[model samples]
Target: MFKMADNYSSSKENKEEIDKNLKGNEKKKFEINKYLPYILIILVLVVVIVLFANLSSELNGISNKLNSLSSAKPTTSVTPNSTTENSTILSDPSYNITGSLIVPPKSLPNDPVITANASFGSRLTNINQPLNKSELALFNNANDSYFEEAGQMILNGTFGGYVFGSTVGSNAEVKILDNPFVVNGKPSVIYFGSTTCIFCGENRWAMALALGKFGNFSELYKGYSSFGDHDIPTIYWAPAHYNQSAEDLGNFYSSKYINFISIEDDLPITGGFQLNPMSTIGARINATNNSVYINAFKFILQLNNFQGTPYTIWGKYNVLGADDADFGFKSEPSGNPSIEYKTHNMVFDNISHPNSEFGYLEYAGADLYIAMTCASINNTAPICSLPVIPKLESYEGYN
Candidate 1:
């Protein structure tokens, strides 16, 4: 009986201890609940601080860029002495200045009279329509397959509807007219592209920037009456690669394309051709040497090696701003393709020698346009006011 009583007393003591432990745990849980809001707030504050630091760095880079741009030299620079000296030189025998060199409106026509109404604007319409239901399903499945193989890429992005291996500029060569042409003692640019090329349109912008160095090439998209419907896009760049959006690219090029004389995809200047301009620019294979496999021909094919809205052209020119990486990068991209041209100097005579089908009268007209672009830009006064696509001056025969 005494032993039983001692056991009972021990059990009571154990119960008391268990009750005390349960109360202590309850108190701890309550205390934790009380401070959870504050702890969560502190975590949020830390995230904000990190984001702010990143934002501040981005702002600093922008500030530096703006400062530099504000300090950039105007496209045209002429000191009083430099102008005076140039005038004196022109009067001398060595520098036979063309009449277009004279400044002011007297030397050339006011603008190009756009006669060809085949505009890029028509392309703007129905450009972004999504595919049919079956097509969309197929596209998604294909894109998922690509990701499963390795990783996701732009080839399987939203814009392209997840079509694997397909790209924005899916073309190879831009054939010129089967005829001879000339520019700065070289061939004209028109001899190199068709109306369908995005690169031809893009190259014109570069040609404009470079020519802006010399003369006042008229702003055409809005200024001219002819390129009324031209709204074709360059390679559709992603938001990462450009400050502007895809809509902005469509709108900007629609409103901003300086309509000189550009061929319409439907209108072949000479031989039959099928190609995208941006692709052609990236590839750097003009029409004259479409069939030739000479070293020079192979050289240009290799030089235009990088892809996706290439920032440079003409061997050493930069189309994008100077801040682009020298080699190239994949940080921000749209339709990135690799291009490599190996040739040094682009000699037209070598590529489009007489007897070549691409060397013809139409080629001469295209050449004239190229010459006009360079002459107008490099000219001190700028006189290329001809229509974007020059007309048949005369198709009389005598080959």
Candidate 2:
């Protein structure tokens, strides 16, 4: 009986030991389940850090490009001032006597009407129009700033590419022959028009701007068209500098590239600004090569029959007006008489308005200048070789 009781006690001790081991295993499983969320969170944090690092690099690249662009833009605006330094006046006697001054007998300060002496009167001419310093300052302050801007835009070829065709102005009807009329061994740009001509008044702005690119103009003076016409404020040929001395022609022409000859055929003769006969003004239009600035005018008439005023002959192309539409068409404003006249007169007055906002026509003028300069046979000036040029596959010459 005692032996049986001892065996029972040992079996009870073995059962208790098995229960303790099972509880310890349950505790180990609970600890592993509790740590699972923390391990997942650490992995997520590592992924977020890598993504943010990549985003930062991309943002930095964009910032660098923006900085480069900011550096390239122009920071200041240019304002044109009419100082003696802006225009170079030659002191040498050789450059002084470009030509004899052509003045109207009535316009000149004289007691009686004077006719040109036979020796002095001809197609080759320049006008001696005296300028009032204060009056000129008013005009210069109104226009010179815009003129400078227009010239730069033409040189840059950024005048909005108004036309892809090589022709300049609306009335490019005539084609110059390839014979290439030369004066003083260089190309000549001949202009035939009148100070009373409103179209010529408007065109002079662009002409001066364009030519100013290649050569300097010293004696250019400000004036206006006839009140009987549109009366637009413009530069008149009266005070323009030209080379008439055959002896000094070669030297002057060599540096200027093209010799510019202009005729202010009619002046404001009466208080009403009536047209009167000026010396050779008629002969100039019908003139042939007479050793005067080459036969550029004759060449123009030869290629295309005489059309009208403001005839510009260059290279092998001739431009009838300043733009394709011919802003200044008639001696007087045309179309819708009531509305057009008022509008036209307003534009004319606005040209000399003290406000800088006026003179949009300068843009058209710049475009014309750019086209003419590109077509010039003697376009060896630095401006002609610019990338902005050569935009025309075929310009005023040849085809």
Candidate 3:
């Protein structure tokens, strides 16, 4: 009886142990199965989120670019404040030039009219007709301050037009077009010059006088240079000396020299090129080498970009180097302190400027790495003015 009881107990114990082992294995299997679905779902969601994020970022980038391109202006010659907006009147696709149709000054007085007698006249030959009498009178005679403000604005950008002429020369060869006085209608132009350049700055009136014997004349006058290395307090290149800023170069230039025309802005410039060439004026107007100046802004566009008041671009030809007595300089110093520095060269003589280089070359090829829009140099108001350039029939030049 005892042995049978013991066997029964042992059998019961074995059965309980087996049951526990089976239970533990079943629990582990259940845990793995439960986690499988969640793991897979989470991986898929992460992939989807990454892809969506990339797509959304790309779309936003494209949208921003589209917005920027939509609004911008170019530098072109548009009719200043003309009602071209209200009316669908495009500019004269075809044009002609009469006494009134004449464009603003482009030539030195002697070579004023781009006629057969002038060297640059051929450039105009391609034009079908003479300039249209698109004359617009400027404001009442303004003051020196007003002219400075206005002229600076012009140098920075464009203003209105003038009934004048200018020489057609490559600014790349020389900085200035020519001493308007040097070849005034190819006349007595004994000498002419300016102060800063020791070459051309103060000679405008003198050259005009020499050429005045012929029909030569000039809208030219002296104020200062457009650029410099440093701005001493009383120096022309310094802001303290002249009220010039990046936004007023063009206005300042026009106020002092060109016909006192006010440049207009605040109009829609749709389809205007960001940096087109037409917007750049010619040698006589200043927009000529602007593109190049724009290009050279990195180096020469500093204080030296344009010289201003009392400081002008001078000219002298009878002698060279005001300090040298022989060529016109001094014995102790480089030259005597006189108005005879660098000799002026004629327009035709420019080809071989190996010895004497002009300011125009640097002006033309300078760096103007400005971005597309809002790239204007002058855009100020309450503009200043100077004496109206004594607009004669044309700019002084040699025949």
TM-score of 1: 0.21
Q: Kindly list the per-residue Cα lDDT of model 1 for residues 1-399, writing each as its tens digit.
A: 899999999999999999999999999999999999999999999999998988866775565455334433222221222344333211101111111111112111222222343423332221222223332222112221221211112212321221111111212111111211221222222112223333433333223332232222322231100122122232111111111111111111111112111222222212222334444433432332221212222322333322223222221111221111110112324332111110101112312232322112112222222233333234222222222212211111110
For model 1, the stretches where C-alpha displacement exceeds 4 angstroms are: 1-29, 34-38, 41-45, 55-213, 223-399
lDDT of each: 0.26, 0.44, 0.23
CA error at residue 61 for candidate 1, angstroms: 8.9
Per-model TM-score on C-alpha atoms:
0.21, 0.47, 0.19
- Candidate 2 per-residue C-alpha lDDT over 285-386 given as tens digits, one digit per residue, 9 for 90 to 100: 344323343233334433433345566665444555444223433444453112123332354354445232234445336445545545665457665654
User: What local lDDT does model 2 show for residue 353?
Assistant: 52
Candidate 1 residue-wise lDDT at 372: 32
Which is superior by lDDT, 1 or 2?
2
- List candidate 2 stretches off by more than 4 Å: 1-107, 110-176, 239-255, 267-290, 293-297, 324-360, 392-399
lDDT value for model 2: 0.44
Q: Candidate 3 residues 88-195, lDDT tens each?
A: 332111111111111233322222222232122012111111112110001121123322332233233332221012222321111221121111111111111112
